[model samples]
Target: MTEYILLAIIMVFIYFVLIRNKPAPKTDWEGLPTLPEYKEIEKTTTSEGELCCQYCGHTETIERSLNSEKENPNKNKFYHACTNCKVILWRSEQS
Candidate 1:
């Protein structure tokens, strides 16, 4: 009618701006394989002894200090070795 309603409003604004501005289909990450460098492994104490969590096997009896003889009010009894998941860590304010 008015030139077919101005060619259906310019084909509905070119189908909503160039087919909705299509650009989203590109993710290969080029093979994607490079993630392995978190090595701090030297854990040994499980012949029925306790203290385990080498990245979460999670056994635990902990709290050791049979007196290396330093009579103190609480030097926190020192059993520390967890610099990011090396896991020995038993000085929780001495109990």
Candidate 2:
């Protein structure tokens, strides 16, 4: 009976040592909708300062917004986004 108890204690100790401190599995943020992508911005705005959105046809100089690339996260990759339709109008990348 004492040997059985010792074996049981050893087994429990091994279980805790092996299972308790295992590193968590890595996660890939591929399917997250909130995550942005580094791609082309279609239906971009005018370069002549027309203040127009080509996709939704929303025109307003004040409502235009500017944003950066998600992957780069720098001022080098700048783009204009429409406040009304939330679409990227124009993109400028500093070479």
Candidate 3:
């Protein structure tokens, strides 16, 4: 009777501890490829463009100063070139 009881207690302990669903082991990432911190952007685009040439009625090629804005209080603030005319289209500040 006592032997049966001891065996039953041992089985119950085994069922709760060793035989029960064990916790998943920690991952060993020694040789694994590391993931990027950010989801990389795949597309590239630009909003900057060339202004229409007023003289020749043609579009001019892109230059660094073509898409830039400047600040000047006294003289011309915004100046644009027109084709091969060599004339500056001076634009004033508009509210």
Better of 2 and 3 by lDDT: 2
What tens-digit string does per-residue lDDT give for candidate 2 at 7-73?
Answer: 9999999988999868765322222212123223343345664446667766652322234245445
Clashing pairs for model 1 are none
* Segments in model 2 whose C-alpha atoms lie over 4 Å from true places: 1-49, 61-74
Scored by CA lDDT, what does every candidate get?
0.47, 0.51, 0.41
What TM-score fits each model?
0.22, 0.32, 0.25
If both were scored by TM-score, which would come out higher, candidate 2 or candidate 3?
2
Best by lDDT: 2
Model 3: CA > 4 A from native? 24-95
**Per-residue lDDT over 18-93 for candidate 3, one digit per residue giving the tens place of the 0 to 100 score:** 8675976533221221112111212111234334444454444222132333223333333344446654433323
Q: 14-85 in candidate 1: lDDT tens per residue? A: 998899878765332212221121122334334565545455545543544434454434554444343446
Error of 2 at 44 (Å): 7.6
TM-score of 1: 0.22
The window of 10 residues in a row where model 3 has the poorest summed lDDT is: 36-45
